[model samples]
Target chain A: MQYIWINGNSDQGVSPDNRALAFGDGLFETMRLSGDCISHDQLHLHRLMDGCRRLNIPFSQATAESDFKLALAVVESSAHKFWRLKYIVSRGATDTGYFCDNTVVPERIMLLEPFTRDVVSLQQHGVSVIPCRWRLSHQPALAGMKHLNRLDQVMARQEWSSSDIFEGLTADSEGNWIEGTMSNLFVVDKTGCVITPRLDNCGVAGVMRHVVMNTLCPKLGLLVEEKNISTFESADEIFLTNSLIGIVPVTRLADKTYKIGQITRGLQRALNTKESGL
Target chain B: MQYIWINGNSDQGVSPDNRALAFGDGLFETMRLSGDCISHDQLHLHRLMDGCRRLNIPFSQATAESDFKLALAVVESSAHKFWRLKYIVSRGATDTGYFCDNTVVPERIMLLEPFTRDVVSLQQHGVSVIPCRWRLSHQPALAGMKHLNRLDQVMARQEWSSSDIFEGLTADSEGNWIEGTMSNLFVVDKTGCVITPRLDNCGVAGVMRHVVMNTLCPKLGLLVEEKNISTFESADEIFLTNSLIGIVPVTRLADKTYKIGQITRGLQRALNTKESGL
Candidate 1:
């Protein structure tokens, strides 16, 4: 990473007793930075604040914005055009126990690193994915908060080491298709409708997933359905979305090979031109 | 805590990029130190190592033992007779992401603090607990490992602030009684049999719980059963077990009051004298 900030201070370390390290009692946001601009900064902040409310962590958007501005300035001054920004707010340090003092001030850590993803090429050619054997556990209390308890994702991502496979798809224990290891999943149907799995039980609610569901799909007159998706029984197209990669089309899953359908291409075009405002 | 050690070095802080803080990608053991001796040292180490194997974190028992000895020596020279020691081994710092480098040497952080629990009073008079409204998620992959994804426990424990309530009992999403907020649950029946929740789907497989099932229960001529326990149905008596607190009899759950039965007492006696080697 080019720069690091802890609670608005430029530092590389945190106390050992920080509850984020202790119990994963925290929330985080990973955003893409092109030049001095952070993509969907407001949406990311809103999601983070919502997560803080759910986890009962004290969060001030004003303070976080100030910190983000400071970190962005550092990144902009560097010799890098494309960078990744990670913002973490933990429940501060605590005495060794799960019983947290809710009144403690939260600790904020921001990390900036020079990162580049070949989004154009990956989106154009599409990527291959595999269904992971490791299933996600259903916890409604923590289902979509983007909180720090991400061992499930870590384990699922470890299932494959093939450089050809861009991502791994995961499901809940009940065999309901959820999302990718790091991004949200969307399947286009024969009637040109977009179907993404409901996040009430498992999987993270990604920021870009929210944008597509609320803005991009509706603008294209496509009916977006959030329901329990089974396997790719009749899917016309499959794509993934995240803040970093924006939209990644999945062309292959195991034995099934899919062509880059019309809806996937249109969404990608809109995302790059009009919707993303890049 | 008066003293802290990180990776065998006496340091108080960790890198901001540590995986533990980023994703709660770590395992920890909370141990008790009494009169310069660590309680259930072997059991704790074994549990930590088992967790390491499950999470794929690099661990060396010899290195951990040596570090523990060094930290214990520091605590031994202190004035306090009773202290709480927390040993945490994270997958170390990484370039911010969930995908881990298995080759990275794990970071060990040991925290020591003066602590005392009135086990005598709690055992003699028993304690009151309530069924938590928050339920544990069913994640068999992460179950029984005591990994750091503890937002479930943190939320459940936040259900009550009353000092009168000693602990909260939690069940899985399917309504199967799992464990206490910080301890494992045991229900004793009129037939002099002991039953604890099956942790195949959820709950931590505690070190002391293992000791009770393997050693204390057999010594007391009690048949131990690990099954899906419904909330106190046919439960003649209920008690909790953990490494720090050996046996805590649950005298009350909601409005249902229980007496300190013979099985509970016998097990506690055996634990303190024979099995625990206190």
Candidate 2:
């Protein structure tokens, strides 16, 4: 495939010694693009900068904005109308191990490529999810930052080799439902309030989850609580969300099944309204 | 910072989109090198391969052997005489995100530089230890392998902002002592048996810990058990181990004080003997 590198101002290969490669010392954002414009642009960048700050990595929003423009330029140059943008800021390689001399500045690399939303499957019918046996490690400091340490999710997703399973739901070490493999999980109670797992300590606080929490909760007159969610067995309706796929309705889990219920459909319509309005 | 890269045939920079950076999808070995030879090369390779197999990443001992030779070449090319060797095998980027179309071939990068062990002040006089407030997430499938999702260690290391504190001791979600920031911890009881936390579903199975476990326990007829170790306040003597720093003695933990006892010195001598033998 075609790609672009942001470091050299021209597309070139990266050194293997990048700290991002060595110790996974970096943060990244995967977003869906429409033509050259990314949906939810400002919010994505906001989360990215928040991640950088949490990790003690610095980011100049002005530079990042220009970099995004250049990244889109690369995608447009590739003649692809829509694609994904992955932004990475890595502490440049130092001597041998994790201990650096604290003199090297981090390298920021951005790439643009063709990506079409999986609209056909997600639109025609909802996805199926399994509560994975894997439990996320909780270190409150690193939780929700979306740093590069994702091997836990990789292993969790590998639990089933089936193509039919769309996403796997993970829990914290305390057995509380957290999120899906690459998305955030949301469930609507019978009282018509939306409930999502609090991600202050573990799982990624997805941008879509944030949007729903920040924008939709008050407007829709629904309560949103970021608290420890009990067993899914007790949930009335289940759904998932991510930037790439605005919102996905979870239809089945184990022997239990959920129809696209009223509250979930309403939330989807609300998100779509916001997206189209933007 | 001198570096070396070995893919299939050529040694170049790693791919920009390598899964290593994307997902921490790799395994690495940090080894001590003296006079251009790795001290227990066989054991290091064994642990590396074991990690690869556990993670479903491929491993070729021959490629690793050549990589070590190349690392030696880089050391010879540099001014420093002694250094540490970091061998990393990450799935090169072919597709986006965690899943790939097929298994991406491993990207091997080695770096060698002047190896400086931890400050002698800590090792000689012993260093203060704080019981980490963070707990290792219980992840059985991903446990024990040196896969790169080390956000836990990053948080643990960052818990202390002062240089006065040398290290932080962490535990699993179950409250058993897992390890230190970058080293495996061992405790000596009044009976002279050495005890280390088992690496069943948490903590790294350090290579040096393995060497001492095999040679020292059998050779010196010392009882070495891999069981759940409690907080340092209860242990008589505690020491840390890694490939880079062979053994570092721990002195104080809250109300408890441990002398740099005879058993710790014996273990250090044994480790030095193995390195010199290599």
Candidate 3:
């Protein structure tokens, strides 16, 4: 597990006062790599930059691109077919307080590791999902962005004890289905329209979610509605999507069970087609 | 600023991967120092240890005591009359990835920064505060404990303008008053009893807030109720509390302003007596 720490552009040893470690004041992006190049690199970069801008962290697009490319070089050198790439931008040394310490620019760290495809997989028999006990907090300012403060997901993931259950559905404070702990949730309504929970107040707008919203939904002429979804009561055919797993069919959710509906499978095929550059 | 890194007691350079930085999955404590020792050191340690126990992060009480003593030693050597101390306990390094990285031992780091009395004293004049647009999500499992994932505070604080507002108050998604960005809020009701928003779902149960409830409330024979507060309209006289600021009276909110009520000042004086060891 090799790693590189770049303070903006220059490489340096780790420091003790990184605010990311101090207050978890940071943002990160984990990318999926194929042939030593990240898939959907542009989309991931766009999200990362947007997060940095919102958080007031100094970001150089060129530096991040170069660092990411260099990390891919390390991964390629290792001869791994598929790998995971992570970019962490941390608020560096400052005047020693909770407030912004502009003295130290953001720290960029990229690490490439062997991707474990076996651990996370689209369930062949279909994934069992549950309505998690935890609910996503509605923080509009932090919502739709992936930041380092993820105690919510950590707690949600801990609620599941069985590996058979691939993912769990989460609700916002109002008991509306929001998203999964690490994936974006979608459901096919009775009219064949795909509905995803609006992430304006809670939940992350995942890169895969963005791609589907921007590309496949329009391309397929599917009526995609971003509205409040109550999976506990009204979801027709629930499914989950993430960069790692393209699409997963949610089979059993508590007392109710969903079949591998045609709409869900169709979207999966469409997304795979897009990924394959068809 | 001078710094040191230690792994279990021995001085060591930074490890290849720190789980605290990786997952923001850790516990931390910020302490106010008086002379050479931290104010209410034992209580802070108790909270830290409690946080670790909740997160399953192993805490070495003896090691923590030694590390805290070391941090105070550096402050003792400084010429500054006041100081701030921070202690972080991470889940230590892992091989890689979120799961299966399985290093159970916690990594503890202590940092000391010297300061002047003027910095904290400015809050006495009362710092302007605003209600953050972002609302805290209620996740009882992760609430109350002060963990490393504090992006909510970071985003809420970023809403500040340079207009010298000392802090911002945040609410839970259900519109229940939580706390100030870095402090706890209490208000005197019309009946002269002190009321504070319960931290059952979100917000840090601040050490100072606890001290006021435990010592001053009892000594003053004032009723303290932990209930869900809706808005500032109900607060007769609101004041904020933290270890750093002994008591900060909120004279104005949005537009409504109240004089520092007699009961509020009485608790402040009584808490000071306990703090100053009189």
Q: Model 1: per-residue lDDT, tens digit, A1-278?
A: 46888988887679988999999999999998877788889999999999999988877899889988987887778887778899988988877777866588899988888877777788889999999999998899888989999898988988888789889999998999999989999999998899999999999999999989998888888899999888798899999999888888899999799989999888887788853432
Better of 1 and 3 by DockQ: 1
Count: clashes, candidate 1:
0
The TM-score that candidate 2 achieves is 0.88
lDDT of each: 0.87, 0.76, 0.75
TM per candidate comes to 0.96, 0.88, 0.85
**Residue A207 in candidate 3 has what lDDT?**
90
Q: Which digits, one per residue and each the tens of the lDDT, describe model 1 over residues B134-212?
A: 9998888888988988999998988888889999999998898899989999999778789999999889999889999
Give the number of the best model, judged by TM-score: 1
**DockQ (0 to 1) for model 3:** 0.44
Q: Which ten residues in a row have the lowest lDDT in candidate 3 chain B?
A: B7-16
Q: How would you order the candidates by lDDT, starting with the best?
A: 1, 2, 3
CAPRI-style class, candidate 1 = high
DockQ of each: 0.82, 0.51, 0.44
Q: Over 4 Å off in model 1, which ranges? A: A275-278, B275-278
Proportion of native contacts in model 1?
Answer: 0.87
